[model samples]
Target: MPETYRVAIMGATGAVGTELLDLLAERNFPVEELVLLASPRSVGRELTFKGQSIKVQDINQIDFSDIDLVLASAGGSVSKEWAPKAAAAGAIVVDNSSAFRMDPTVPLIVPEVNPEAVLEHKGIIANPNCTTILMGVALWPLHQYQPIERVVVSTYQSASGAGARAMEEVKQQAQAILRDEKPVTEAFPYPLAFNLFPHNSPLDDRGYCQEEMKMVNETRKIFGVSDLRLSATCVRVPVLRAHSEAINIEFQQPLAVAKALELLHAAPGIKVVEDWDANYFPMPMEASGQDDVLVGRVRTDLSHKCGLELWLSGDQIRKGAALNAVQIAELLVKKQLLKSKTVA
Candidate 1:
């Protein structure tokens, strides 16, 4: 048997952090010791792990010397501050924030498509944005058959991608609207209940939201195609869990819907749910709480040669953040990277 790992979960109280805790237990990740870390405000808080209650530790006070892996999901700033420190202390850090993804030195990873990149990491591995992760998962198989020339995507993301405060905003706004009261906005610039906002984050100079740019850049990095043409429009919807995207791709070689479906169905970590005759397709409600990226609504784009379109959906906090990080940690263990007590 492989050596058990000592794992630390930073941001133990947030939505994605909490989901990581559950995933660790569910996957039986060969964890010998689990350290839960959070900000000073969450110190002394109790969180249950493997039937035992564990107290959350303020990140500043924890010793990382013995930790085999650190899964961080606190936020970009927290990750930027602590990830390198933890790595310097000898733990492999799998980060769920956008802090290090574009750092060139840090490998932006999606295990199914780029597991080899994890080996080239300088101590930290960055998880791609939730939207980008699912998009790449659905496209990689096709890309392998025929290189994609260009990609156009529009995301219908969930409130959970913004964090717990945004989820509460959706719930509160929904209740107020039902009670004949005007809903107030706090987590979003506009009321999220019964509404759709075309913006997912602050817009960059190119007029694409930050979230959209993440999809553009991360996709190129994970695919190792720096010149890959990609454009995205990310939007926030009232959905509470899973995020969905409409994707159009132009490939170098022709790919039929049937062949694409076959490839997606055989791909690991993906589920093909295209059955239009049964009125079945990928939806946020069904994709919620599931680990697989659901793909459906496949059709040929009539506008261009070798063009195809599809819909992708998955739990933002799961495949998007916590679950993917945990899976990378698992890969580290399987490859014996986490077993060695070496830091680089």
Candidate 2:
């Protein structure tokens, strides 16, 4: 029998955190003990796990000595402060925030593409952004066939990527607009009902949103191709869950659509759902709540050599956050790197 792990989930009350709990149960991850941690505001709230109620605890007060792994999705600031403390106490921290992703010593991992990177972690392993994670999963298989030189991608990300509050904000605003009342815009900069926002995060000096920059940087790191060129446009769509992307890639060698389909079909963690003639393609509704990244609409790019264009979709909360983090933990366990001494 495999050794059961004692796990702690930081931000257990949020959307991604809640999804993490569901996934842990769904996958039947060997959990000898589970600790649910949240902010002070959420303490004492009841959350059901494995058919039993588990009370949420304030993350600030918990001791981490017994935790085998810490899956943190609380936010970058919270992760920045607490992840190291958990690590120092001999727990392998798999963080979902951007806090430690770009750190030279911390391995940013996507289990399908870079599981080996987990072995190089210094107690903390970073999960790639939701958009980046799905994109890398689809692109890695193609890259292995013919080296990709550059990519241009546009994302239609859902509100759930922000949090449960953002999801509620969209729903509430839509109803308010129907009732002729002014819609609230606290969670987002603009009304997210029947509209789209081009900026997914604060703009950098170069005019790219932080979310876009993450896709560009994190892709390079995960693929181990630092000089690869990538340009992205990330937009916030009004959809409640799942993110969709249109990507065009320029590769070193020519790849046919039939061959590309073959490669993608065989890729791990990817599902091909293409049937253009039948009016079938990857969609947000279908991708929501799914664990696999769906790919379709494969064709030749008109403007570039060895070029290919495709559409991809996945649950931003699952493939993007929770499931990916848990998958990393599974990889650590499979690699025998989840042991406390290995992390320390």
Q: Give a tens-digit lDDT track for model 1, residues 188-280.
A: 999989999986477878798888899999999999999999999889999999999999999998899889888888998999987788989
**What ranges in model 1 sit over 4 Å off?**
340-344
| Residue range 93-167, candidate 2, lDDT tens digits | 999999999999999999989888987999999999999999999999999989999999999999998899999
Which numbered prediction scores highest in lDDT against the true structure? Answer: 2
Model 2: how far is 300 from its true place, Å?
0.6
Deviation of model 2 at 76, angstroms: 0.5
lDDT (CA) per prediction: 0.91, 0.93
Give the Cα-based TM-score of candidate 2 against the true structure: 0.97
Collision pairs in model 1: none
- Model 1, residue 139: C-alpha shift (Å): 0.5
